[model samples]
Structure formats: structure tokens, C-alpha cells
Target: MAQLFTPLTLRGITLKNRIVISPMCQYSAEDGFTNDWHLVHLGSRAVGGAALILLEATAVSAEGRITPDDLGIWKDEHVPGLRRITDFLKAHGAVAGIQLAHAGRKASHSSPWKGGAVVPASEGGWTTVSPSAVPFTENEPAPHELTLAEIQQIIEDFRVATRLSLEAGFQVIELHGAHGYLLHEFFSPLSNRRTDQYGGSFENRVRLLLEVTEVTRAEWPTELPLIVRISATDWTEGGWTPAESVQLAKLLKDRGVDLIDCSTGGNVPAAQIPVGPGYQVQFAEQVKREASIPTGAVGLITDARQAEDIIASGQADVVLLARESLRDPYFPLHAAFELGVDVAWPPQYERAKPRRR
Candidate 1:
């Protein structure tokens, strides 16, 4: 069997294959609620033969939303619709996962379609909060520095979200600690300038994420897997580094995080990231070897051979596809055929599948 077609077992959860549908924000929710669009969007990927279908960065609080339209699971009301999506994904043979996140200083922005800029409070955006009161950009307003009490509350919020995710039948939970979001900001020196227990030294900077993982682990089932995505490098001097990411990954693993999904940059506006096909794969390779943890490689990984090579070469345990999946929801199914891997197509789509080799 092709390496890409081999099942991966992590903490008692077995993936059908190595292909994962990376969480991509739709920015189509209202009051952080999921609707039919989520079901169809995630369900199609499951049916397309992805081993994992991860929901987008779901906010743990109303004010933590990336935009007014960002999906949320802060309330019990959000569970029902999310359950529907997870149910469909699992029924179609994919593990359902959710990325629980808090946007911090990046919260309350206009959607990418709206130019992806920060929104004003008068425009319905709330005051953003972070480890420090730093603005994402000079033009954006400074966020409120989180108090110790608020930090503790946020940790509890993640724990609650984990419980809600399990209740919705999601088998995997990934903490959105990357991309200069709330947790990433704390890790980056450029954004986090503080003297508190949650800031300053590297240990202090990573404190919130570490604590969040611990609380989440306590709430998330022991048999289920937990993942944390981290910006392995901020692509800027004085920013977070791949070396730091390796150490953090080790800490995360010790805290029960099964995999480190390596993606880079996004903590600062001026950081230079060399973007290309499989550009982020090297970080995963480094973390996987040095940190001795499973890693997921994402970013511009669009072709069957490229993904298969990643697995075959031991670069990463899972290949996460985003824009490519959007361009073709059935990319995994097509990939299976092209790579000579015999993944079963749903009975309804079997007749539509290409002729066997």
C-alpha cells in the first residue's frame, strides 16, 4: 500500500488516510453560529476521501471572533449545528476535528472579501484583548492587555470548548496557537511586551498556550487526540523561531498534544516568508525529528505526488490541504486514483469514479 493510504493511529484514533482537510475560514456565520454552508463545505471533503476534516478556527468567546462572521462554539446553542457537520463527516469516513481559537488583537476584522482590515468599535467590533496591549499594526487600535483573571478565564473557555467539541462528536481538537492570533501573539516578542508571568521570557511567553493545553487535556477525553498548530518561525528577527518551536513542541507533547502542525509567519506584518510549494514542510520535518512528535505539513501542497512524497520521505505524518481542497473538494479521491491507492469511494459516487488501473 502507498504510504499516503496507510492509516495513522494517534491516541487511539485511526485516520483512514494521511490526507487532512485543513481548516479554512468561510466567514459566513452569524453570531458565531454554523449553518448549512458548514455542513456542505466540510461534508464534501469527507466524502472526497480526506482522513480528517478539521473545522475552521472556532472562537471560544464572542469577542474572540476573527470577524463578525467567524464561526463560534462559545455557547451551547452552537453545538447542534456543529454536531450536524461532524456527524456528516464521520458518516462519510473522516475523523471530525475542530480548531478552537481566540483571535486576540486580530479579532473583529473585516472578512478577507471585505479587504481584511480591522473594524472600528463604532462599526460593531469589540475591544480586542491580548497578552499585551499591542496593536497588530500601527493603524489598528491597541488591544487591552489581558488581566491575570482574564487569562484564567480564557483557559477555562478553551476547556469548555473542548468539552463542547467532544459532545459534538469531534474526535480531534487542534488549538489555534499559530498565525499571530491570540496564542501566537503571546509567543512572539514583537507583539508580546510585558513583565507579567504570562510574558517576558520564553517560558512566560508560552505560558498561556501551555496552560490552555493542560486545561484542554483535562477536559478532552484521554483516548482522543489533541493537536496544536504553531508558527514555527515568525520569519522576522527577534520573532519566534523554528528552534523555539521545537522546544515548545516538546513541551506540548509532554502536556499531551499529539501533533505539532507546523506553519510559519503571520505574527508580524513585515516578516518575510518564503512561500512556495511545500515551503512549510521543512518546519514539520524539523519538529517531527527534533521534537520527536508527529507533525502535519500544510501550505501550497496541492498535488498527489507532492503529498505522497511528503509521507514517503517521512517529512510529515499528515498532509493538510487548504486552497487546493477549495479548488477541488474531491482532490483526495482523485489523488487516490492517480497515486494507485485504492481508497473506496462512497457507493453513491462509485459509478462516477474513474476506471480502475
Candidate 2:
């Protein structure tokens, strides 16, 4: 049997296969409300045979949104619209997951399609906040440093968002600790320059993420799994290192985190990343071995043979597809054929599946 088609169970949730649809922001939302477009977008992947389909970085608070158009769970009214999408994904045999995030200093930006520059307060963007008054890029405006009181509010926001995720029927919750967002900003010394308990050392730097996970875990059911996405490395000298990521993953595992969705190099915009197929898989492998936790390998992993080797060789427990899945929603189903794994096709589309020799 192909290892890529093997089942993986985390905590009490069992994935039908190791294939996952990584969260890819659609940048098509209205005041945080999901609509028919979201249903079709996520639902199609469920039909495509991915064991899990995680939603994009859904802001826990309105300001946590990466852009004005980012999906949100800050208000109770947002639950019903999200429930509709979760229902479709589950009905199509996929486990629905969500990445709760706060963009922090990176917030208040125009969409990438709109040139992705900073959007000032008068232009519908509000003042951005972070662990320190640092802008992502040197020339951009420095964000307002978050007060201790405001930091408490961020934890509460995550708590409330976790509860709503349950109400909306999401099966898994992944905290967005990576990609140089709010949680990442606190932990990476390159972005954080605070001297308080929230910064200064590795323990202090990672304090916020651990707090959020603890607070979020309290509200989240024990039966379902909790995943944390980390940048693994800032890919710049004197920034967060792969060694630091392994240590962080160990701490997260001790706090009841089930898996590490390992990806790297989102902390600095200009840092040169060695992008290639399977480049980031090594981070996942290192963390899985050193931290004694399951990891998911992502980034440029687009082939059945490559994904199979990743799982089969014990490099990572799961392989998440982003752009590849967008290019072919049924990549998993096609992969099964390529790897000679006889998995079921959706009954409606079974006729179109390629025949065996």
C-alpha cells in the first residue's frame, strides 16, 4: 500500500488519507463573512479527496485580519456562514480545519492583487500593532507596540474564536504562529525588541504563543487535535533559527499540541530563501525527529512520488498541498492512481476516473 494513502489519526480525529489541502487565502470576502464562493472553493477540494481541508488565516479579531477582506470569527454572527462551508466540506468526506491568526504589524494592507502596499487609517486600514514598534520592511511605518493589557485581550480573542470554531463545526484548529504574524513577531528577536517578560530571551520570546495555545486549548475540545504552524527559521542570520524551532516544537508538544505544520522563512521579506521542491520538508523531518512529534511537510511538494516518499520514508506524517491542489482539485485522487493505490472516487465522478490495467 502507498504510504501517502495511509490513514493518520491525531488525538481522536482520524484522517482518511495523508493528503491535506493547506490553507490558501482566497482574498474574496466581505467584512469577514463567507459566502457561496467559499463554499464552492473549499467544498470542491473535499470532493477532490483530501483528508483535511484547512481554511485560510481566519482572524480571531477584526483587526487580526491580514486585510479588510480576510475571513473573521470575531463575531458570533459569522458562525452561521462558516457552518455552511464546514457542512459542505464534511458532507463531501473532508475534515474541516481553520487557522486562527492575527497579522499584527503586517496588518492594514491592500490585497496582493491591489499591489499589497500599506493602507493608511484614512483608507479603511487601522493602526497596526505588534510586540514591538517594528514594521515588516524597514521603510514601512512602525506599528504601535502592544501594551500588556492589549496582549491579554489577544488571548481572550483566541479563546472566544476557539469556542466559535466549535459552534461552526470545524474539526481541527491550527494556531497561526508562523509567517511572521503576531505570534511569530513576539518570538523572533528580529521583530521583537521588548525587555518585558514577553520578550528578551527564548523563553520570554515564545511566551505569547504558549499562552495563546494554553488559553485556546482550554476552550478547544480535548478530543480534537491542535496544530501550530511555525516558520521554523527566519532564513536570515541572527533571526529565528531551525534549532530554535525544534525547541519551540518540543514545548508545544508538551502543551498538548498534536502536530507541527512545518514551513519556513516568512519573517523577513527580503531574506533569500532556497526555494525548490522538497526544500522545506527537511525542516519538518528535523522537528519530527528532535521534538518527538508528528509533522506535516509543505512547500513545492507537487508530485505523487515525492509525497509518497515523504510519508513512506517517515520524513513527515502528512503532505499538504497548496498551489498544486489549486491547479488540480483532485490531485489526491490522481495521485492514488499514479501510486497504484486503489482509493474510492466520489460516486458522482467515479465514471471519469482512469481505469486500472
Candidate 3:
């Protein structure tokens, strides 16, 4: 049987299979509100037979948004639409999950369709915040360096967001610590050049992320799981390394993080990343082995056989897919056929199931 089609449990939540819908930003919200587009975009995957369906990079504060259109759970008003989506996902069998994020210096950009450029304040963008004032690139504006008070406020934002995610009925919450976002900024020396307690040494640079995890855990229910996604390496010399990620994963696991979703690169514009199938899987393996915590493998994972091999080989506990899920929401269902794994299709789609040759 395909290990990818087998059930896996974290905390009190049991996913029907090992396939997880990796969080992919839609850049399709208005005023940080989720709408019908989000409903269909996420819900159809549940109906298509995924074990877990995660909402995109949702902002924990309005100013933390990657784009003006990014979804937000910073306010109580955002809970209703999220409730609608989670309710539907649970009713259909998939465990509803969400990735809570703050974009840091990467915030205030146009949506990809609108060219994804940094929008000036006059063009609807607000000043971005980070552990330091360093901009993501030369063309981007220098962000406001967060003061001690502001850093504490951001932690509260995550706490409140976690509370709202629980109230909205999501079973899993992933702290977005990857992709050079706010948490990633704290982890990457290239992005965080602060001399305060939030930067300089490795321990100082990791302090904010741990503080956020502690606060989030205090607010989130014990029965639900908290996953933290980390970029295992910045892929540059003197950047955040896989060893640091392993140590961070161990610290996170000690702080009650259930899983480490491992991905790499995206810290600097000029960092050389060796991208290919399973390119990032070794990081997951090292973290899982060294930290003794479950890790989810992602990046260039496109086929059922490859996903199953990752799990079967003990490289990762979960195989997360971004582009593959986009290409086929029914990827799991199709994978079941190819891997000789039995998975029940939604009755409405049963007639469309592949037949034995």
C-alpha cells in the first residue's frame, strides 16, 4: 500500500492520508476578508480527497500582509468567512488548517497578477516592519525597524489570531516562518541586522520566533496541532543553515510545535538555490532525525510515487505539495489509483474513478 495514502495523526487530529494541501497564497482578498473564491478554492480539494487542506499565508495583522489582497485573520470580523470555509472542509472529511503569517519587509506589494511590485504608500501600500530596517531588495523601501514594544505587539497579534483560528474551527495552525517573511526575517542574518536582543547572535535572532510560538501555544487549544514552516537553509554562505534549522526544530518541538514543515531558500535575492525534485527533502530527514520531531517535506514534490517514497524511506512524515495540488486538486485520488492504494472518492465523483485495466 502507498504510505502516502495511509492515515497520520498529529496532536488530536487524524488526517485520513499523508497528502497535505500545501499553503499557497491566492492574493485574492479584499480588506483582508475571505470570500466565495476562497471557499471554492479550498473546499474543492476536500471534496477531491485530500487528507488536510491548509489556507494560504493569512496575515495576523493588517500591516503584515504580503499584498493588499492577502487574507487576514487579524480582526474578529474575518472569522465568519473563515468559519464558512472550515465548516465545509470538516463536513467533507479533510482536516482544516491555516498558515498564520506576517510578511515583514516583504509586505505591501502588489498581487502577482498586478506585477507583484512593492506599492508605495500613495499607491495603497503601508510602510513595512521588520526586526531591522533592511529592505528585501535594493528596489524595495527600507522597512520600519520594529521597537521592543512593536515586537511585543506582533506577538500579541499572533496570539489573537490563534484564538480567532480556533473560534473559526480550524484544526491545525501553521506559523509561517519560511520564505523570508517576518519570522523568517528573525531567522535569517541577511534580512535581520539588528543589534538588539532580536538579532546579532544565533540565539538572539531566534528569540522572536520562539516567543511567538510560546504565545501562540498559550492561546491555541492543546488538542489542536501547531506546525512551524522554516526555510532550512538560505542557500548562501553565512546564511541560516540546515544545522541551525535542526537546532531550531528541536527547540520548537520542546516548545510544543508538533511538526516542522521544511523548505529552503528565499532569504536573499542572489542566493544560489539548487532546485530540483527532492532537493529539500534531506533537510526534512535531518531535522526529523536530529530533533526527533515530525517533519513535512516540500518543494518540487510532484508525483504520488515520489511522495510515498519520502514517507516510506523515513525522509518525512508528510508530503506537502503546492504546484502539484494546483495542477490537480484530485491529485490524491489519482495517486491512489497509480500507487494501488484504496481511497474512497466522494460519491458525486465515484463515477469518474479510474477502472482496473
Which candidate comes out best when scored by lDDT?
A: 2
RMSD in order of candidates: 0.9, 0.7, 0.8
Candidate 2 residue-wise lDDT, 1-357, digit = tens: 999998999989999999999998888888899988899999999999999999999999889988988999999999999999999899989999999999999998989998898888888988899999988998889999999999999999999999999999999999999998999999999999999999999999999999999998889999999999999999999899999999999999989999999998787798889999999999999999999999999999999999999999999999999999999999999999999988889899988999887
Clashes of 3: 0
Local error of candidate 1 at residue 264 (angstroms): 0.6
- Residue pairs with backbone overlap in model 2: none
Angstrom error at residue 204, model 2: 0.2
What does candidate 1 score on TM? 0.99
- Could you estimate the TM-score for every candidate? 0.99, 0.99, 0.99
**Full-model lDDT, candidate 3:** 0.93
lDDT (C-alpha) at residue 265 in model 3:
81
Q: How does candidate 1 score on lDDT?
A: 0.92
Candidate 2, lDDT over the whole model: 0.94
